[model samples]
Target: MLDLLNDLLWGKVLIGLLIAVGIGFTLGSRFVQFRYFGRMFRILGASQAFKRDKHGHLSSFQALLLSVAGRVGGGNIAGVAVAITLGGPGAIFWMWLVGLMGMATSYLECTLAQAYKTAQPDGTYRGGPAYYIARGLGQRWKWLAALYSVLLLVTFGFGFTALQSYAVATSFDDAFGIPVVFTGLGMAVIVGLIIFGGIKRIARVAEVLVPVMAVGYLLIAVVVLGMNLPRIPEVFLLIVNSAFGLEPAIGGSIGAAIMMGVKRGLFSNEAGLGSAPNVAAVAYVPHPANQGIVQAFSVFLDTLVICSATAFIILLSGAYDPASGADIGGVALTQVSLADHVGEWGRSFVSVALLLFGFSTILYNYYLGENSLNFFSESNVTLFNLFRIAVVVLCAWGAMTDLGTVFAFADVTMGFLALANLIALLMLFKPGLRIMRDFDEQIRAGIRHPVFDAKKFADLDIDPAAWEIEPEDIERLKRYGAPPPSASQPVK
Candidate 1:
């Protein structure tokens, strides 16, 4: 049943919808993701990017790291390997294409999220597809918003977290002979500790750990690639040829490549899946597009950089044979490939890297659930506490469950979640474009840093408090050469 459902969703319905929506968003935004690619890094490094007057609000950079933490997980490592195993080396080509198109989709959805974000009573912001659908589209769409929230809670809150925990436990078990149960229990305890500390603590941990783990993994992949420099061209040719069915290797059908690549690509970067926007909306950016641009870059980092690293490691090592029918796949394939390159230590390194990647993702996934719960009821302490406990328990339970079952379940839920968000994105397309245009107009007018003025968008249902500028802050912006607060711009 799971396989049948997955085939229907990934092979038929989602593949077309995802590509169409991605192309639509890209065209609608005039390819904003690529046009502002360089600006992404600049926005992250800008001094204003770190400003947060509220105690609980995340800086843009922190939010980027948090979203990246959620993105660069087992999907980059194990999921990449799965794509190769089931869809052939050609599947990677599809993954690359999806990542590129996803950049635009990510920008649109994330910008809308920031625009519709609500100012919570606790001095923080909360929003996502649910918030945008409800608030941006008005009272008629609240049910759709609620549905998206429920899908989010089930997909990221429970499903993805459990799957991540299982990945970590399996890797540890394979590497150190640790009991899966023991590893699961330990992870559950740690997850409970950090999640209880709230979003700030999660942000702090992501800020420190995401960069370290991602860089470390990439460094090792670089070493493997360097060792196989001569075969570099061969690997590229193989992926391209296999993707088109010109090279008839195992699992090399063009259809399989497209299906697997897109499935795994969405799984890895989550650009259009409504997941990252949860974190994206939490950032304190001068303009919604600033964070949107920052997040578009994350898709590139996850799929083009990190995931490609894992793929190259496996392909270049000559450890993975397309014709081999061996049961070794997923993290095992990655571990074996690295071990073949470096030695037994390579295997241990992958286990450790996966542990860190999966752990950070669990933290990120938990926050998404928490954010969704807040959407339903912000002040329900008992309910929130119970949800936290459920998260911890699910983390442990995930470790002990069958890996295939967990992954299958996650994929189904993720498909539905993405479907909801994509529908909302299509409906709210013009508003998103309007927000992007506001940022673009400011930039063209020579504003060094664009500030969102809620009054300018009074026609939209944005939360005024969320975008309100303090008098002191306005003065501070003027000192930095930002334009003064002015009357509403003519709505296009």
Candidate 2:
């Protein structure tokens, strides 16, 4: 059954759709992901508003951390390793390309998320692909929203939750001989404690842990790369040459590289996966474009930075051979590569990284499922909790079972959800473009403190005073440079 589902989900139809959607977003936005690539970092570095702009929600940084918590997972390690094993080094190029294009997809989805966000009675916000798809795409097409909710609840909460648990449990057991059941139970307890506290607690935990884990891994990768410095240029040449079916470096055809890269890269950053947008919606910022900008940077961090770090370390270590050996797959391959450089301790460290990375992803995935459940029934909080707990148990089972089946099942479900989300995003691409234009206008006008509140629902009763833009903010905006349409433009 799982094999059949895999065949159907990953068949040419879905693969074509995924690629087409990515290109469509890139073309529709005129490759805004690239045009604004530098601006993304500039805005993040220079914006006092992004730093201090909190409206009773997570700061832009914290929201970004929350999004990163999911993207920077075992996929960077085990999944990337698997892509190389299955698709070869050339796959790395495709992954990078997909990630680049994915930034725009992330921006578009996040913009829509903010555009359709609904405030909760408890003074918080909730919105996601479903909300944007329904509201932005129009009420009549709400079935797309409903379908996404159901797919995520099962795929993420139930399916991928299990996969994450398995990664944690298996890594520990492989590294330290700890019982799998013990690991699973302990993880369940930790996750339950956090899920019960809601998004605030999740954000608090992620803000600290994501940075630590990402920096620590990058540091380790740098050390490994330093040790293999002489091989760096050759390894990169191989990745590029193989991407175009050049015969010398990679023995395999270029098609393998493209397929593997697309599959693994899309899985890595999850730009169009519809997962990150759920987290993006929770942010309390003035403009959806603010969070959208942050999310674009996240795709860069996930694939360009984190995933690349892992790929380079593995490739440069001289651990893999494309010609002779069978493909070394999953966390085990990463362990072997790291161990070759840093010894047995390296393996253990990868295990710990896997646990932290996978655990964070599980928590974020459950939160997405909870929101998906919320869309189905506002009063089903208890049921949502119950379903979430069940995910922990599934995670346990995932660790002790045949992961091929589990992974294949997850792909089927996630691919379906991603397709549904991509459709919604494409349908609402115009709204995202409009928001970007509005933000650009505000920036050019020297409107630093532009009012960000735009209500989608007529029933939503917002107080005018709460959303008023201040003149002082306009002065502050001047510091960032007059936005494109504003007369404060630097006199050329």
lDDT of 1 by residue, 109-176 (tens): 89999999987666568889999999888899899889888988988898888888887898899899
Backbone clash count for every predicted candidate, in the order shown: 0, 4
User: Each candidate's lDDT (Cα)?
Assistant: 0.87, 0.77
Ten contiguous residues with the weakest lDDT in model 1: 47-56
User: Each model's RMSD to truth, in Å?
Assistant: 2.6, 4.7
Steric clash pairs (candidate 2): 443-483, 444-483, 444-484, 444-486
**Predicted candidate 2 versus true structure: per-residue lDDT over 1-492, tens digit per residue:** 877876676666566766777688788777877776766665555444644543344556777888999999988998889888877788998999888888888988887787677766554567888887776666788898999999988888778888788878878998999988889888888888887888888888997889989999999999998998898898898888778877464534677778888888888899888898888877655567877888998999999999998888788765777676655668888888898899889999999999889988988888888889888887376887687668767766776776776677778888789889878876777777877777777767766533354433223222222233334444555565533223321121
TM-score of 1: 0.95
| Candidate 2 Cα misplacement greater than 4 A, ranges | 42-55, 249-251, 401-404, 448-492
